[model samples]
Target: MSENTADVTETATEGQQQPIELPADHPLVKTLAAQKESIKELKVRAARADELEDAQKTESEKTADRIAKAESEAASVPSKVADALRTHLVALHGIEAEDAELFLTANDPELLQKQVDRLVGQSGKRKKSNFVPREGNTSTAGASDERSFVRDFFSGN
Candidate 1:
């Protein structure tokens, strides 16, 4: 009996840390306790509201909701695919991601390529030394480039 009592007390002590005592008369403590109680009440009310709303929903209404959600997700797939393609094209063309996002909005990769090619072909501001390297020997290759090379696509000659 004494051993069991000792085990119980040990467990209780283990569960507790030393308390940081604040005066109960403190206005901040009072407000904090009030807020805690208010949170509990609000949580209860929200749960009850959800339960009532769920109870009010018919089987058909739930099915319709699921269908609508699925439809919305389905509608977004093309946009996601196009965005992925755009990102790939941006990296491939050595165009800045921000520049592509701002200047290129077309869904067609070929069209976006043309747009990027035009931007690269037009802008003579970018120096040979300023080429953003993509693949091997780009620095050595771009350093001797004639002119008209885009960001960094100096493969042969």
Candidate 2:
């Protein structure tokens, strides 16, 4: 019975010592306690805002990368189209390689043909190289004597 009484008194003393009161005298503590709910709400809102900002940055970077890739591809399109046009003119139209550039800017077939004729006429004005062997050197073995066998091989004998 005495031990039970002592335990009851100790519990009462501990309960008395533990006061469920805020530090009312401290202004800062009182303010923080008063605004605790609002502070949590603000923190949550701030975190959400930061998350949204980071997401926007990520999306913007991705968009910028996509735009950069598109710009690069766009820049090369003209050259690719020009090369295809040059190939078509050279293979199908029998335009000279040196005169291909002049026809690239021409829109219609008639204009392109006119440019081709102009280029052919200009080519006629230039003197031809005398590299062609004379009729006397028609023999293949004799032509080999005039030029090196390697040069003849490379020149498509």
lDDT score of residue 9 within candidate 2: 77
- Each model's lDDT: 0.75, 0.69
Q: How well does each candidate superpose onto the true structure, as a TM-score?
A: 0.47, 0.31
Error of 1 at 79 (Å): 1.9
Best by TM-score: 1
How far residue 156's Cα lies from its native spot in candidate 1, in Å, is: 45
Task: Return the lDDT, model 1, position 119.
Answer: 72
- Deviation from native of the Cα of residue 63 in model 2, angstroms: 0.1
lDDT of 1 by residue, 11-121 (tens): 677996544445688676899999999999999999999999999999999999999999999888777777787777777778886777788886655676677777777
Model 2, span 1-85: residue lDDT tens: 4665576678688776542333457666678777998899999999999898767787778789899999999888766665565
Count of backbone clashes for each model?
A: 0, 0
For candidate 1, the lDDT comes to: 0.75
